[model samples]
Target: MDVQKTEIWDTKMVPRMSQFRAFQQVLDRTHSHWDLKNSNDDHYTAEVRRHTVNDFVFTELAADPLTGNRTISDIRQSDHHYFCLLYLEAGDGVLRQGPNESKAAAGSIALWDSTRPAFFGTHSQFHQFSLLIPHEVALQSLPGIEDLCGLNVDGNEGTGALLLSHLRQLHDTIDTIDTQDRPAILRATVDLMAAAFRPSEEKIGGTAFRRALLTRVQEHIIENLGEPDLGPQNIAAAFCFSPRYLHRLFNQFDMTVSDWIKRSRLFRSRSDMETPYLDGLSITQIAMKNGFKDSSHFSRVFKQEFSMSPRAYRNQAHNLRLS
Candidate 1:
């Protein structure tokens, strides 16, 4: 619940000659240590309002034209390990992390990892919201988060739009929200951010990239197992891959996409059948809930997979629990 506001640089307080140095000191204290260059030293103006909500830090920054670079030395000397999610609210800029360089226009979000070197610059005056997410928390939500640095999350469409709206609302209401509720709200924001980032078409690189992407796709399928219309075509479309390419990706694991979906659904259904809390639901209800359309077909597949009828399995589970 701690909030800190810093007027990073003011033309009147700090003379033109000493403005850059004073700004650098403020930047070091308020944000990450960056090798900063003033694009408009003659007209320097910047301010920052920072709020610490549990493990996350939400910052609002407005500044004149400038560029900040995190060099190798800066990375090595700094102990900060976090991911920065920067949303440009008023102006555009170019952000570079690793070999990836992307344009971050207004209403767009860009991610950068603190452990790596990066470059950020704005051509004109800009206002932005930057959320500093601890590394462990970020990785827990999106294991492939590092790959997202230097990529743009389009805030105008889909989940990105939702995330943008959430961020703006959070910015407006953070002060009024109760301290106990801040953590939950921040966690939900992170989840929405992960969802927004995941659907973007990641660059298909070498073996490591492919392996990570495949794992992500599998995780996505597992999460959506109950969707009746979940199939290779839709899955492929969701991940921005062609159906044929998706099939090829699954083929590498000696599993077909349809078979994987069916097996996942069957296993999920079996688990639900055995759960005591789900006992009130009938067998056919459980089957259809896990994406099976016909009761007879669900029975045949249940037997094929678990060697038992769904009803018999549920009964056995209930008896075992009683014993």
Candidate 2:
């Protein structure tokens, strides 16, 4: 995306005595109020890289040991509230908000809310990436987000590992992505975060986790729709779950695994039939391209889905375009 980036503050750019003030001013303009503390006055060094991807913001920070707080006064002065997800790349820290508190280490993630009071402290040199997601946008994917505040999600296993891995890759390749693709990428990022923070199976009966896993599975199915062997058993194996459990997961949405795949293939073929450029391909070819081995069966399902044969739908689309 060749994401537009700004080096908001670099202690090396200013005198030693003015470094802290410069850092504070930069924080005031970019983030909410934060009271910063450092042990060594002469050795303090810090740098911040800010990148805006659509409505979300990513800040990469590297600095010496320090402690900071977003006090009650700071929350009162802020205009917009945000939910920040911190991905720790190095060092360790402790975060506290309300009555919740946690000790975070490398490869862990912490959630912070700007609408409430919070405290964060780093015990040594640190490097981390922070994703500042607006409260409204975050609430869309994570309705129970408030429960996640002041907690550290272990990013070394399960869905948390997947989310952190995706974020790290995004950070490394943000420059190569096209601007038009940023919004969708950011949306997926939020989805992963929501999935990672889902409550334990004992608490919510694994409903949220299942939803997240289903979304990932559906995306994988779409990407591999051209493969003739893509089916329920294989899909379950891909995600390291049992075939019976996979079927149960789909049942939550009142769908059978095979039925869902058939519907997806039918929809793709139908859309292609309506496109002018794809008019050159025969009905059998289109069906085969979308994983339907039997053209007659594909036609029957298409009629049932769209209330017309594929050929009729394509011809009607062509006539409409001509008119």
Candidate 3:
């Protein structure tokens, strides 16, 4: 079969009486090598939306129940090898990789590797989000992360909850993010996964632990950016870490915690300023809404960051939209 690079948002729907051949063909192109089978070949229905996000591919699929297998030969035939993180938005399934097997329910996340043979069986019609991460990048982000393959992380509470929320927000606000920030977002995703699946015996001072902590801190800053008290001190207090340690963590990423908060607020404010639905609000209101206490300060920083005043940027964006 010929393979080509997928589009940014490629949507494919199964048609009638093809015996699921088309479904399998598209799946192989968008995903990895797989031999698929379903009880309803004549009437099997599936919709797949594959979206590209920087180095990762985020795919949303809604389909009738099916089972798939990848054997050693299948793996060798596939051109791409990577780690897949799957979130079951609405489905139940079982995934087997190596000697590990996991039962997946709605709101559960599972990790698996494409280099290994695996089997997946779904119990009912379902919706899912599959994130494909490059193999080298995954290993670099969290050494030994492959050990967690075939394990499901419960999305109801603890670190799992935070990871789930981050993924959802990433999807919802993807269009608002700047091109330069996309890499950071991808890195944070890996860190969050490591945090959720790191072994219980891992040391707190480990590299993965530090990266995970940094991700958590960055998320906290994002969630509380609108608060007047959102600064290093308050953030450290919330995380039960010393302010010095927070600074040290950010330093490792070549960023200052306070600067990141300001940058995040600025980026959010800029996105709002460009949106048509927010046109009624003045530039000052937009700045304040994004944690800017002083309009003049906000204007100064906005111009420095984007080489234009917020009002000018909004006007330009509006003109482009009208054109």
Candidate 4:
């Protein structure tokens, strides 16, 4: 995606007083309502950069202090059922939905449902990244999402920290990432959020927690596959989980942590080898590229998993393409 084409709205393009109206117009198009508290023309400024990938929408918004609402009346006016996960990059705010209210500070995240009446107010200049997932799509991953509405997840520790870090990275690289990869990245983001919100042992039970943790760990491994030191201990430390606990989480998957990493590396290597664009690359080069320090060990694992050498697999792919 072109970086310049990524921005959908900017206050700089409009006059001072019209800034709020322009922002509202963009919000209307997305089936939401905004009520700007600071009606003073001199004080209003805003910008939104939106990137839509499949059913998810990643938006970066910067603006002066203001209040917004998604009410039952508003919902009737425009019925686009969605769930928003807002991560604050700067400033502070409060969100209220039904009986729950939470304060959101920089590095913190808040979840809100569009089908319910909700209100959020920014108290100062603010910058935020919001991931809008369709209600149906989010429900598929997080069945108990209703229990999380208006809840604030602290992004400084635990799965929340990992979720925040991954979101920031995605926001930073969304434009540069291949169009084919965006959907997978967005799906992973949703999975991480579902995990981040269900931290209570009693609420999600032990099994559910383990599954979410496994998903997060797998995502971390895939993202860092190129790092030679990417292992259970380092990955555990990254998410503030103990090495023993990390291994325990993978037990239910019937695979050890090391086994999963090796499998993932081999899978990626096979994918690259099958690509005609990389056909000219040597097997050893492909092995190292996929984080295999020793080509001999990679070859051993590849043949064990696929019953064929990497070179043989590539040759078969070439022959099939030629035919």
Maximum-TM-score candidate: 2
Runs in model 3 lying further than 4 Å from the true structure: 1-15, 202-323
Q: Which ranges in model 1 have alpha carbons more than 4 Å from their true place?
A: 1-12, 199-323
Question: For model 4, what is the error of residue 240's alpha carbon versus the real structure, in angstroms, after optimal superposition?
Answer: 37
Clashes of each: 0, 1, 0, 0
lDDT of 3 by residue, 247-304 (tens): 8886644568788788788878977876788989999999888899999999999999
**TM-scores, each model vs. reference:** 0.60, 0.62, 0.60, 0.60
**Model 3: how far is 316 from its true place, Å?**
39
Candidate 3: the clashing residue pairs are none
Per-residue lDDT tens digits for candidate 2, residues 1-323, read 23354556688999998887788777766767887887877656888888776557778888888899888888777756689998878899999998789897899988888988889999999998988887756754664467678998888899989988998998888768888887788888888898888656564455656767876887788888878888988999999999999888767545788887887888688768767788899989999999998889889999987678898988987896677
Candidate 4 regions with alpha-carbon error over 4 angstroms: 1-7, 39-42, 204-323
Model 1 compared with the native: what TM-score? 0.60
Error of 2 at 208 (Å): 5.6
Q: Tens digit of lDDT per residue, candidate 1, span 218-314?
A: 8898888878899998999999979998887767555788987887788678768767788899999998888888899989988986677888988
Model 1 clashing residue pairs (backbone): none
In candidate 2, which residue ranges exceed 4 Å CA deviation? 1-5, 201-323
**Residue 188, model 3: Cα distance from true site in angstroms:** 0.9
